[model samples]
Target: MSMANLSFLNVLKLDNNQFTGQIPLDLRRLDRIKEFSVTNNRLTGQVPALKKGSVSVDSYAGNLGLCGYPLPLCEGSTKKARTGVIIGAALGSAAIVALVVGGGMMFVMRKVVRKKKEDPDENKWARSIKGTKKIKEG
Candidate 1:
């Protein structure tokens, strides 16, 4: 039988069990619940909000996939987290691209500068010779 049908239940403890799947949201309908515990279970999915102080972190312990208030916010907690990750990855990629292009340009410029320094007058002499016409040796 479902626990939600037990509307008159005041205290429910199902700790240290092999229960799997989500804790039913209908459990919140048990208005008479004064104490609830589902710790040490294989429960997954967000834990439903029950009585104000009836549930705590300890009540949902050992369930790694469970989340929501009274525990950490559920994974992906809407699109904000996913969007942030996407934006972060995009910015990281852009930075990498910028670094690669900048490094390539710097390397090319350095090579040109070194070549000029090594043969400062090589091109100058060639240009001067081209400008002068050869005289006949008769």
Candidate 2:
């Protein structure tokens, strides 16, 4: 059911074919496969790991259902794993937003405090009435 038995075959190029189904799990046995390509096919499932430099992600492009390693992990593959990733991302985003908002609030509060310190009467509730009373009496 796989191409593993083809011992003498050193290179296999099956790009742009309408091939479907998972990659041969026994593909790792092809020790002499110096170059391989299976791009632009309708294949699915995790690609079998071959020797380094024997195949690259370019060899497996155009297959949407493929996942792992060279491509991102598939959604819903592991509920716990996916949930952990989501939680981590949410916490990271919340931390950034909190930092920005807290920093802004601190900046605004510091400005208000500094302004109040610069002119104490500017914020007093009775300063205007006191000024009016002084003017009337004068």
Estimated TM-score per prediction?
Answer: 0.54, 0.50
In model 2, which range of ten residues has the least summed lDDT?
129-138
| Candidate 1 ranges with C-alpha deviation above 4 Å | 80-138
lDDT of 1 by residue, 63-99 (tens): 8889898898876677788899999999999999999
Against the reference, the lDDT scores of all candidates come to 0.85, 0.80
User: Can you write out model 2's per-residue Cα lDDT over 1-138, one digit (the tens) per residue?
Assistant: 558988767888888997999888688788778888888999988777776455767878888878755667656668878799999999999999999999999999999999888777775666556556443654
Runs in model 2 deviating more than 4 A are 74-138
- Give me the candidate number with maximum lDDT: 1
Model 2 Cα displacement at 137 (Å)? Answer: 99
What number of backbone clashes does candidate 1 have, counting pairs of residues 3 or more apart or in separate chains? Answer: 0
